[model samples]
Target: MMTGDAELSMFPADSRLFEDSFSAENTYRVSGQNITIHQYYCANLGVSASVWESALHLCQFFESLDLSGKRIIELGAGTGLVGIVAARLGAHVTITDLPLALAQIERNVACNTPLSGWPSGAPAVCPLSWGRDLHRFSSAWEFVLGADIVYTPETFPLLVDTLVHLCKDGAVVLLASPMRREHGAQDFYSRVLPEVFEVELVQRHPESNINIYKATLR
Candidate 1:
């Protein structure tokens, strides 16, 4: 848990952060497999179109776990990197985000075909807006993942509601995000999340200012 007030740097919430003026595709090597992601920088899409450092850290953390045959669903799956990695590691993954973000995620999933020869099938891409259409999804997932999804305080309640809905069947939730103090990321982890679930800081990559949290229903 984070303590006392400290002069923290602000996490730029500007949409310009998503702009990659260089290449439309970024390649990442995860779990010994190379996953290429296609990203869009439409200002209307906000941060949902780009892959953040938290997603990369989550992928690194996933490398340490045996995700084979696990039923996983990822929320706010920007660019689908974490879910794609989980699928590559043999987990049955469903990667979801807002409706507009699905196209890029679908494209990435298609780009990484035959994920690790699992033969189970490719990841399913869907649209999920927090706190809405909760019944459209099942609560039987074995694992729920979110990377960099806590930066917006306005969505904190909805995100928590969605997590609670998804974890009703005892599914474990893994959330990874940079502690962006300016955006209340710390508060979401330290205060908001703990209010509903038993939260534990499983890993902290201090060099990258990212923390991976494991949570389950209280």
Candidate 2:
């Protein structure tokens, strides 16, 4: 059974989630670049089809960084917004999600193709189930990104393992998530994550109840 906060995190309080069927093309201005994302809201496709507020907050946070030429990868990149923004800011970004979620991410990536400052055109869309296929990815990334991915308690171990694998070379890990108490976000950040990485709360948006954390291999 999903907790109230978990359900709320999965489905935003906005009325749009109740629509019979809908898709939205929302535009965002990040790092002086305008990015338009196409999002589909369907119960069948699960939470990966919609854009989360944590993603927007993370994109805003990215504006403060110099991402030029940095090798970055985003895990559970729903709608690929954060990765797209990073690519626009000159980062070579790879966006990954579950296999079922890749099509939506690919469409969003394609919609924003030829992102300025991206070395090899659009960001690469890949399937990455945490704790699996760890060998396929190298530990050479400069940054690892995730937005609103730490809600479920059952996935904590897998997610931590993936983070350890990716940040083996001291790559910085940035995660943005809502403070969903019932969903175990606090425990994950305070207890589980600290066991593996040295974590720091870099930014917090009170109005949105979102916190951005920066972690590095200890």
Candidate 3:
């Protein structure tokens, strides 16, 4: 029941109820920007709004910077919202997610296709699984973006390795997530990334209920 320029659908189990509950589709309205993103189904292995909000703030921060010509890649792009916004803001952005989630991300990209104006090029949607190879998207990007991707101690090392592998030296790495569960990811970044990355807390959103962080290659 999403009625707009976007003919988006919902997951079967959650679709009917969600459609009936809200008169309009839910969207993230980025501050200081005219762009907005609409999400339909959150996929099976979904990320929360706190993550999305944090990513939006980080993206806004990126937009505020001088990135007229820079290569960017977004990891764990559940619905491609952050990547799309980055592309619109003139970064050569590549969107990656689990293969299973690629279709929905592509759909969301297509949904906002007209609005996303990357003069350099359109953002490429690629498959990238953590702890796996990332050669297809190339090994160079000025910045690597991730939102709500860090979770579970088991995946921490691999995520770090992946980031280090794909990002070039001096590349800025941006990550946003809500501190969830008892996972040691916060500690891992605090302890480990300093060896390779200059980590900094950019924004803590109590209103949006998320924490957005920025890290740069050291």
Candidate 4:
């Protein structure tokens, strides 16, 4: 129910689902199973509002890959969509966000729990913030996932550091982000990431202007 330039623009007003105050619920069918997510919008915390395009792309990326038995952790998980899908696909997943987003993530995780054929802890929910609280994890993770987490350039170092700390054993980090013309996020990812880890483009789509990158310690 929008009009004017919003309805005419090609960028998809769906991302704006996070920009205002509203509650959202959606069922995502992945790998023959459907996972439902609950999201609440807070004008003050826009990122937690709803699903983003990068998440859907990431879920598709996961569906095509082999993640069985992997100890996976998803950072910056908004509505826990990708992680929930991964869980349904049989990966041991822990979906995380900052403390403010935990309740929403926990709720979605509960909705998809005991992922059919998988064990009881198919998907767990947690609160994780970059740089300051890496100690909560006592072990290294095999796979790390992030969707649309590269917006702010100022936090690049902290985010990269967290990846480094989590994947000390050479685990791969999968990050999907839309190419932004402003904020220097693209530039930082190109320059800094290679200095610390080996980077590769897993997929790219000009239409959506999103790129999924797979990185590991060099």
Candidate 5:
């Protein structure tokens, strides 16, 4: 149940959510700046429905926060839309997903960002496989961002493991997802995430089915 404005914030100037296919380009406009992202709709290689509704929720969250100069890393970055926005907002951002998504993420980052838009230049793209690849990154981030990532049941444990290793002690972590629990994601995340970090539910707006959580290491 997204608000009208929230739904509009999900796409760019000329974007259509359900026309053609997910491979169609998506446009996003924020604070007078514009960005376009391309998404591959295939899920077999670990890519799923291109852009998600929770991403819109996260974008709104970005507008409300002061992320200036923060070291931010986004796990499960699909099209890198949120990370691109974070970089554009003056954070040193790194966007990661499975290895297959690296090239597309890179392309989106490039297409959406101008040379002058990113205060710290472009976002770093990394191929992350959760528990198996936690060592590739230094565990010293000021903030970690995730959107629509808490969906798969089998990946839950590894996702938590990666989150624990990425954030510094007491670092802020923000995660958002639609309360779709068909695969048992809601149950697992709500139960286990608090074990490693102190968690609080963030109320963004009244009508969103998307749930946002604010957590910090204990």
Candidate 6:
């Protein structure tokens, strides 16, 4: 329950879920896992529809892979859903997003898995901003993940830089995007990423119109 104007204004009508509407309690089932998360807008902090779907699609993709003992990091983790799924699937996942999304991410992290429920290799949340310093994070991760994180053309370079910096040598980077034209994000992957990563479309969810790419360090 919140009363502040900031919090009240955060929940926009366009994104609101009514209690009685079908799927009002938004949730997605991760493929190959016996887990379904009750996803929702970070009511205290806005989220776009693309981000929500992308997160679910990415989580399902990860669940379908062999990630028994991998080190994973997720960038722009809006609600930390993908990272949470990764953790449940046995990867050591670190979730990072802009500071504005941190509080909701932390709350979601707590709700999904409390301290006592911190499994052997559960996920953890941290602050990471694209185009900014990442010195706070430890050495590179074996796999970097993101979903619908490419919003503006201006942030494209920074996202690429962050991905390159976090990807360990020979490690893989997985990202999902609902193809936005003119954003130049797809171009960055086509022209720029090849210099540092061998990229390929590993999976695509046509139903959701989301494209998932797997990039390995070159």
| Deviating ranges (above 4 Å) for candidate 2 | 1-19, 115-120
Query: Local error of candidate 4 at 25, Å?
Result: 1.1
Model 1 regions more than 4 Å off: 1-23, 115-118
| Candidate 4 positional error at 10, Å | 27
TM per candidate:
0.88, 0.88, 0.77, 0.86, 0.83, 0.77
- Please give the distance, in angstroms, between residue 78's alpha carbon in candidate 6 and its true position after superposition: 0.2
lDDT of 5 by residue, 1-218 (tens): 33434422322323243444346687877644477888765433233337777776787787778878988999888889889888888889999986667888998988877766678768999987777776678887988999888877656777788888887655688998887769565685568887888888885444767888898877
Candidate whose lDDT is highest: 2
Give all candidates' CA lDDT scores: 0.83, 0.84, 0.66, 0.77, 0.75, 0.67
lDDT of 6 by residue, 47-148 (tens): 521237777778777756877668888887876778877877777888887666677667666656734565545577787766465667765578888887
Q: Tell me which of candidates 1 and 5 scores higher on TM-score.
A: 1
RMSD of each candidate relative to the true structure? 6.4, 4.7, 7.8, 7.6, 8.6, 6.2
Worst 10 residues of 4 by lDDT: 4-13
How much is the lDDT of residue 157 in candidate 5?
73
Question: Which residue pairs overlap in candidate 6's backbone?
Answer: none
Candidate 5 error regions (>4 Å): 1-22, 43-49, 115-117, 204-208
lDDT of 4 by residue, 28-136 (tens): 7666667787878774346665788888888888767877777888988978888888877778888887666778887887777752555525577887767766888
Superposed Cα deviation of residue 83, candidate 5 (Å): 0.4
Pairs that collide in candidate 2 are none
Q: Is candidate 3 or candidate 4 better by TM-score?
A: 4
How many collisions per candidate? 0, 0, 0, 0, 2, 0
